[model samples]
Target chain A: MTNNSSGSRFGFLIPVIYIVFLLLPIYWLVNMSFKTNSEILGQLTLWPTNPTLRNYTVIFTDPAWYNGYINSIIYVVMNTVISVLVALPAAYAFSRYRFLGDKHLFFWLLTNRMAPPAVFALPFFQLYSAFGLIDTHIAVAIAHCLFNVPLAVWILEGFMSGVPKEIDETAYIDGYSFPRFFVKIFMPLIASGIGVAAFFCFMFSWVELLIARTLTTTDAKPIAATMTRTVSASGMDWGVLAAAGVLTIIPGALVIYFVRNYIAKGFALGRV
Target chain B: MSFSWMAWTLPTAIFFITIFALIAALGVWEYFSPGGGPRVGILRFETTRGDRLFVSLLGSAFIHLAWLGLGGPSLWWALALSVVYAIGVFRFV
Candidate 1:
């Protein structure tokens, strides 16, 4: 009885410790966000000595900050849609067909995911520049496709492979068209894969500074870029920077929470 | 745009040409070279996955280097190289 109680106690303690570790940086950021620039550097306060929503008010009332949020959301959605649409067909083809070099093709696709993002950032900037698409949400959206597409392909392939090939053959034998079969039959089976892929696309697009910043100037800068504006020689606005950092976590956390149930049983089942 | 482009331009152009020549040479070399599959001597054969991954990583490293040494505008080479490497893996490896 005592051993079991102790074990349960430790189990409870583990999550508490983990949460504290994770929340500490976030807490500090939020704490500073409520303080004035002077108070942020004035002294250490475990809790805000004088809390104010002044920073948040500044962000909300300001045109640039709110506009950035709108632009970020617009492109993130664009990248997600493009990546999933292209990857779904390509993944299904790779999973179902026994083409000439199926194994080689799949590995090649994985290699794209493994490729570092930094390298692609430049080519993307130049490519977009040449096309006169620079400083637009579309430019960042397509540029992100380089990363998101491969990821979507990989996850969808894993989900697709878990499904029995017999199901596909049987469906076709029953006279279902390829598109109908894929949309109705195959999609439901891999719904979780789509969710997981969307999560990744959102996460990558949200946190990504290099491509987001590179592709966008004033008209289409992401919130991550907007965070950098707080730094200056006159003085850093610790309050706004912290508030922005705290706010950045919200989109990602909400995504994971909504998809938390499906994420566990996804993708690790099979690899085609 | 910046003088930094000069830093990698010479080395990068040379590096790319060398890889192009090497891949072609290896493809040709594969035909004439002796027994294949993990040979210590000349014409070695890589598994399909191995060839695809090796070339992809090799290209990625250079792409990453280009991003760091210069600024990040040459990733087309990485993307284009991977596609070619994929073709090689599918066709030859």
Candidate 2:
């Protein structure tokens, strides 16, 4: 009994320590966002001595700053929605069908995701420019889809496969058409999987900087890109940058919170 | 002004429109046909489409990471290696 209790206590300590380690960067960002640049340069403190909302004030007041957030949210949402929608059918195809070159095709799709975003950034810019797509939220959204779609398909496929084949057969016997069955029966069964996939898609698109930066100049600049502009002739606005970073983390944190229960299974790709 | 979408650039507008179009197309395709058959692949285990996708994606990530870690002037080589790796994954993994 004593051994088990000690082992449990040790396990608790491990996660507690891990959580603190993970939170350190975030805590520092929040901490710095409240401090003046002079104070930030002057000392290292656990918390700000004179917490100020000045950093946030700059972000909220500046159209350039706040617009970046809006642009980012726009593309991120568009990308997530597009990725999941497209991936649903593709994932279903992967989970259930075997067409010619199906394996090769699926693999090829994933390889697109593996290619460095930098490699595609220039090409994406050129392609979008040819179509006159520069500085658009959609340009970033579509560019991000290159990565997010495959990931969504891969994640959702795992969840879809876990579902028993018998369910489809039974629904068919009940005379439910494929579309109806898929919408009413199959979708609900895989609701958690969809949530998990959407969460990942949102996170990936939100944090992605290379393609987002390359694809947009100003009209649709992402918060990540906007934050980089803080470094000017004068110097870095560390406080404002830290505040932007804090704001950037909020969307991802909110997503993880909403899908907290399914995240473990999502990470496992539904294998667990 | 009630949320002036006119402030958005042409490319941004097009990009969004394209996404909606793609989604609509996919929906149409799914409605017209159904997918749910399994097949044996080059892999030892009988894998459906999803399994191969998972393996390929997982493999591709490693391949890119490895290529990056090896330190090269251009990622073009990484892209080439990834294609080969992807083919191999589809054919055998």
Candidate 3:
């Protein structure tokens, strides 16, 4: 009885420890963001002693810094919407039918997700340049589609497969058209899957640097790319860099909070 | 405490951070629901989530290296090929 009790106690400790380990760097970044560059470079304090919001103020006031955030958000949102929209019908078809080479085709879609962004950075740069899309939000959004579409389709397909064929047949018998049934009954049934797919798409596009950086210049530089400006004549601006890092995490955190339940389900479903 | 000697670039740091984050996320997923039971894929061997992830990462490294070895001018197609390889690893291996 004592051994069992001890095991259970340590079970909670494991997850707690894991959570702390995962969050420590983030907490450190936040702490550093609130300190001066002198304080940061001078010593490694556990927390900020002389706290200030100067770094944040700098970012907010600077167009180069703030515009990066805006550009990143625009492309990330555009990519997520486009990926989900394109995947829905494709996912439905994969789930509902078994046409010739359907399995091969479905597997082919997943292959796109495996490609590393670094390998495609130069090609995407050249392709977008050829089309005069080098410095545009759409270029980044469309390039991201190369991977995000496959992931969206795969996740949505897993969810759609969970839904029974009878639902589709019943909807048809009730005189519902394909598009109407898809929007009304079918979509609602796998709303959580859609949520999960959208979340993944947003995250993949958001954190991806190589492709995003290659596709855009000043007008559409992502926050991650703009972050390189910290290395100036003086030295690295550690405080502002830390502040930018904190800000970059906020959107992802908000996204996770909103789709927390669906993400949990996605993990359980083993589709993510 | 002094990480200066490590000479970490932003992208390199971010890459390591992402790998750690993924591992942590996988740990959390395993904790919440323990049974990520091993299943035999097309490779005819049992594998779990972590196993598949490891295989895919290893395979991607080879794909990239092979691309470099072959002196490919454009790596997009190599990347595309790697994607297919990774998907295959996850699905079959």
Instruction: Report the TM-score of chain B alone for all candidates.
Output: 0.35, 0.51, 0.79
List candidate 3 segments past 4 Å from native.
Answer: A1-9, A232-234, A264-272, B1-93
Rank candidates, lDDT, best first: 3, 2, 1
For model 1, the interface Cα RMSD in angstroms equals 6.8
* Candidate 2 per-residue lDDT over residues B1-93, each given as its tens digit: 122423578977895796467445544554466352356756556764445555655676787788789787587787688678767765664
**What is candidate 2's CA lDDT for residue A103?**
65
Report the candidate with higher lDDT, 1 versus 2: 2
Best by lDDT: 3
Model no. 3, DockQ = 0.03
Question: How well does candidate 1 match the true structure, expressed as C-alpha RMSD?
Answer: 8.4
Q: What are the lDDT scores of the predictions, listed in order? A: 0.76, 0.82, 0.86
Rank by TM-score, highest first: 1, 2, 3
Report the C-alpha lDDT of model 3 over A1-272, residue by residue, as the tens digit: 33666556568878799999999999999999999999999988999998999999999999999999999999999999999999999999999985544554676688789988888887677677767888999999999999999999999998899988999999999999999999999998888899999999999999999888888879999999989755464378999999999999999999999999976765666543
Which clashing pairs does model 2 show?
A94-B50, A96-B36, A96-B37, A133-B11, A136-B12
lDDT of 1 by residue, A223-260 (tens): 88887864553267778878777777777788889888
lDDT of 3 at B1: 31
